[model samples]
Target chain A: MAICAKIDTYEQMYLIRAFEERIAELFSRGELFGTTHPCIGQEATAVGVVTTLEPTDVVTSTHRGHGHFLAWTGDVQGLMAEIMGRATGVCAGRGGSQHLYAENFYTNGITGGMGAVGTGMALAEKQRASGNIVCSFIGDGALAQGILHEAMNMASLWDAPILYALENNLYAMSTHVRDTLAGGIVPRAGALAIESATVESDDVFDVIAAAEQAVEYVRENSRPYLLELRTYRFCGHSINDERAYRTREEEDEWQRRDPLARLAGALAETERRAIEGRCRARIERAIAAARNAPVQDLGDIGKGLWKS
Target chain B: MEKLTVGRAIAAGLRKKLADDPTVYLLGEDICDPYGGAFRITRGLSSEFPGRLINAPISEAGVVGVATGMALRGLRPVVEMMFGDFIALAADQLINHAAKFSWMYNGAVSVPLVVRAPMGGRRGYGPTHSQSLERMLLSTPGLRIVAPTPRHDAAALIGAAIDDSNPVVFIEGKLLYAAEQATVSEHYDIAHTHPPYPAAVLNNAAGEQPNVTVVTYGPMLPVVEEAMTAAFNEDEVACEILAPSEIGPLDTALIGESVARTGRLIVAEEGPRSWGWAAEVVARVVERWGDRLVARPVRVAGRDLPLPTARPLEDHVLPGVETVRGAVEKVMLQ
Candidate 1:
């Protein structure tokens, strides 16, 4: 068992938590305009899975991808600037929030578009002999899309090096997973004869262990595998969504299972305090950087429409 | 110099491109293995380059999506849709994802992807497979549309498309693939003469002052040429035939220059009339020289109905040689 580290992993979780909380505040204050699917309670899954990846490896994220993007790639400044639709944003304001994408991270704003695209990215990686694996992160709701199955089947058949990470956060917008998906999600991958495992989202170390194993399996065999992180969202689907669909008790229960606090508790008392302090300083600096960033002019909308 | 058919020239160009760039690869149905494409354009390719020439399943959307993904990852991918009409299945990936990726990412990502589809309706492939959907793609903003009319243009334009750093839709005419004569050179030495991808003037039949200008491309080129020749012999009317080899950047300047000189213009297309490539051409011409036109700038196109199954009805529905001739006569009279 690989012992969980406090400095790197805990700092990432704190940064994601701080980032999502700041985004929610900015959005509620009307400073940030556009749809943002905050990864508030889902920080552990992104941190655990992304920590297992290197800078060279590629990943395709879903709409609720702030945690994944910030965890694997750049910091909160570029992400917050992106959400504010500024020229300094990672995508230069064209991709606002739902469309936040970066080439280095191999990220796209697509909802379920990553499932198939990740398969292609993995094929490209395999062809280049880059020894890099592609991780495709999708919501449990995306399992029902036909494109996902098509990509999984092809990836398995060709033995492409890919990890299909299903962040089963219990709800797809308003409907529960049990309502939208038939049978269980992990068993679906087994039907395709893919090696799959399910891990609790609250257990950050366990999720990381599963991700590490899956990544190694893909790299060794050049075959696809599935890892389902059983988690729950503490907030509604989007900023505009109300909690009418679920109970406050359900939300409170997930909040108590917050992966950040759980991971922080596992650390030494002095180390935990030091890590939290560093995370706070980083978040404050990022907030200042994003708030002071230059705004994008309306004329700049057509500037980045093509490559010269 | 050797005379090669358009299909042969395309195959030769692809072969040269694959040999030149290790990153370039071909993917499509029947494009590899025991059979090399239905049209045999990719014949003998799988044997020459075993692993590079990939034969994908009969999934148009999957192939296109995969190609887009590959292109995003620094590999130039050429994906073929056996028939142009079947490209509809992959429109989501092509129109929504591949086209918008670069722009959506604020030019951070370039989809160096080529989607090659054999289009046009002379073979009686029926309604499902014979429809020309180039106009639908032309309406898309981020894609470069190229249709090569001549053999040399077919060979040269593909090289340009392969070299382009943007996503391109290379629509090859099924009728011209086996009929048109091309002068192809060896060693992939075709210098890109035109501006990356632009409209080309195959023959300036009218010399300096052409009274009527005929605008057409792809499979409609032969019909336009035959109609113009017949009209010249019968009525002694000299017309200028202009073929816009590339459609997306559209080469509005070339079309505008010709329409401006001729004063009378007739745009012909094998696809439907409404919102077709002809509409874009006419709109650009009208925007530039709408006041100086001899007539309303007549548009000659196929009927607005679904392509018919019967031979006679299909022939009637499609723009024939006489139909283009009639449009030329009408535009000249006005």
Candidate 2:
């Protein structure tokens, strides 16, 4: 990747981190209602994979999809307004945080059961032969769902151009990946004769490299590929969760490997300072934009509630 | 015009639609080859359409999800659930994804998909197979629900559903398949449009000045009509029957007007009484023109308990002509 692209990726990841942290703050203040699954620690995974794809390519996201949305094609102000249930929000306040739908990214609220739905979208794209691949972002927990298996089997059998980007944040709410998945997920995909790779999701470049290869394989052969991103969530599962399952040492260890800090450190001092200033300015502007936006009314509730 | 049963009518309609539009495809379990369908509704369709009529695995969600995907890609996919009760397994794809996609996507996408499920209780298929789940689907937004009581209505409704740019849950009554008859046309007539709402008045039986108006749909239409005739002859009351072809976008205007004119209403449904289609009709009528009603609206629905397998118990559990007529008489007395 070029130096400018690398800097842009870093800035994007930082913006996502800042946005999520602000959401966490608002959630704690009881300003934002509803359960929010923050993609705090998994910022690199979202930014990296999305940065690799063109704007025309589509993606299907999980409940913790703010990072993915921001990474691909979402405006920060519209996203914040949506979380606040404002009329000017992306979904006109009907979708709230979980059901946010922007240009190309489709966010599924609490139902992590859309693994097959994403595959279906990919199949449609493939049939259109639009030269646009679909990247389905799923959590490690959703692998247990029967639909994921069905989607994988169908995508593989039909040679659908789909990239299954599994964000293995180690824990699904409170349960660890090892405790939930048998023999882990990568080997499971390998058993199906599908090409699979595991990347250090805390490193943005590592994830980007893996995503690039996966995207290439899917687009070239019209076959599905699985890329397991091994990362961790720095915060609790939701606003109410205290994360009593994991140890303080584990959390601290993962925090030390924060992607934003790693990328900031990789740049020159002047470049790092300039990038940090730009990201802070962007976040401040987004916050100002959201605060000034009008809240959505009950009348607009039914606007985007159904398709015409 | 040759008379044809609702089942044969549906098959004929599918054959016609498939021939007319190459994009149209049929998918379901046992819908291809030697075993056509559980009810033989798709009999001879496999050989006629070749690879277009797909015999999928026993995965209801997979079937619906695949159809939804195909519909998103511009293919007019007609998916069968085998039985209405089986739709529960595919509820995630049907309710969350398909029903909400167009709206969630800000009208950027439309789920032009039709899900055909066999509904109603008449074959003594027990609790699992015998269910009119049109009410369940009607509760879901962005989904157009259609129930055809007669053969012509079935053909018209199926063609309408196929042409519709929205997701449609087309419920076919198992009893209507064998009982009702109508003419089935081969040519695709885009002009043959079924009203999205308001019940179809199959027969006024007693012309104008109808003393009683019986509202029913799906398989129970024949039962209500028969019971209305028997009860009226046994007594001296005149009755008119109205059956709605479309369940969703319910023609409230037609129903309210009919109730206002007849001054009496007796809604008979094969589904559960609580929050069923019958309840919707009563609510709509009362909300719109309750003051004009001669008597309180009455509903005759299936028993709250699960449908029984025993022939005697099954017949007793389902709403028959007697039950409907009794309700009609009771409402008329009030």
Candidate 3:
């Protein structure tokens, strides 16, 4: 059985895909404020990893984190407002898309920085016996950072209840993982005593199965678990990238294996059409509400400089 | 009232806070018992708290990042960076995350985290081990930097740092740890309840007609106090000192008031003269008391060079009592 119904997972994935598509269109028209790293082809991984989490459990995300944020909060209006830098944003416009924080979700613009933070949160939960597990999502490129290794070592040492989920999308902004990363990311963490596993496909059911097992293992063993979710990004690194590195054939191959279409194929036609309709309607409402929402005043930018 | 070295005082403060609050815990390199921290500030803490005192790996960024996460989860974690200099490794976390989490999150959460590190030079620890990095910390916004003067209680300051509903960097002076008996002198006046520990008055023998106001903090407090007293009694310089026990969000008002009255000012510190905390003190004073100054304020601080390993060389490079005394006289005469 799936952690979430197959139909529900499809809806979440559809929301992610539709949200990014709208953001890209908005960016193209100079409507969206900042650049975004869309997870167009990796929807399954984002929703799959997050569905295993309880409401009280925490997660930390990376720069390309819209999908993760939506999977965690499902607050489309607040999230879109944040991406648009509106006052009704989750962070009151201080944090845009890259730095969205909600009830238990936090995403920063820095690579691999959330690793230590998530590990620490897991440590806190274990100390309190809260039974809540933390998941920190990172990309293949973040493997170059040394801080991640340090957090991994301490996580294993402390037996923190955390899932270090890696979305190895083949490229770290065009510099292929093979070119930048030395040795295997899973083995490097394993040397620090972290239990490691890897899922082979980007299929929603496969991701749910692998991620559910990983989340459960960490919860029961009370240790750090590393999961390498094999996936690919259909788009370039960002809106600015020209993609002169990879061939067109490579892009086409990845797009053909799109996680969104794969999940839709698994769902019944009526159910799939309904979920797509709901996602489109919700996205349209969220975008309209976010645009109508007022932007933060220039004077109030520094209002909360310190917590009195 | 308690007789304790600065190190012991810090340990006592941690002990008390942990006992009082179930949420408070400690993490740092060699912080557990048997090792008791590099300077013994965490001595016997692990034995008392057991699993609460966690000895961390040599990963400053990881430790601080983890502490920030813990704070996010509502745990009051006091992290000990073995050396204040090593805090540079964790600067990104302190400056970007811990310092701004609540504010960036728009007051959605409060990070009640404490980072305790020993600062200042003079223990022959050389460049990497010894540095008065408080100057760098002072430049970081949204973070409270607190240091202790001999007049203020170290443990009390630590307790205050822990109690603060924000991220605080509690800088402990290595030299202060060597004091066999801790006694807060009465002449160094002024005492505030919280971090940015209250500024003090020194060498006000003339009471109402003090000739100069010298501002300093941390380990430089004693040296500046001695110099001010010697200048007042022998040289008739009549100096009044305003030294905040805490550093950041400096209490420039106290120094400004004293400077306005004296018409002369001197800022003495252990860090380098260029871009030191003295620069900030001078800037704040000049903004308000520029018209009142009878002479240009002098900054007495370490030379802009790496601290040498030899004791004599280090003393020569760092600002000394004679240096402060001379600056006081020079400012008074002008």
Q: Identify the leading candidate in terms of lDDT.
A: 3
Docking class of 1: medium
Top candidate, metric TM-score: 3
Candidate 2, residue B232: how far the Cα is off, in Å = 3.8
Isolated chain B TM-score per model: 0.93, 0.93, 0.94
Better of 1 and 3 by lDDT: 3
For candidate 1, write residues A1-308 as lDDT tens digits: 32356567888888888778878888888988878888888888998999898788998888888989988874677777778777788887777777767645655555566787788889999999999999989999888777677778778777789999899998889998888988888887888888999996557788888899999999999999999998877877989989698888888888888888787777788887877787678767766776787777767666545566
Q: In candidate 2, residue B296 scores what lDDT?
A: 90
Q: Which one wins by TM-score: 1 or 2?
A: 1
Pairwise DockQ winner, candidates 1 and 2: 1
> Per-residue alpha-carbon lDDT of model 1 for B1-334, expressed as tens digits?
5557788888988998988999999988889967889888999988998788888877787778778888889899999889999889888888878888888787778888999999989788899989999887887888888888762457667888888878889888898888755433221112223565645454434344667777888888778877877787788766666777777766677667777777888899999888788888888899988877878788999999888878899999999998988887788777
> Is candidate 2 or 3 superior in TM-score?
3
Report, in order, each candidate's fnat.
0.59, 0.35, 0.74
Can you write out model 3's per-residue Cα lDDT over A178-266, one digit (the tens) per residue? 99988997898779888899998988778888998999999999999999999988877897778898999998998888888876777
Off by more than 4 A, model 2: A190-193, A297-300, A304-308, B1-3, B20-23, B183-198
Minimum summed lDDT over a 10-residue window in model 3 chain B is located at: B187-196
TM-score for chain A as predicted in candidate 2: 0.94
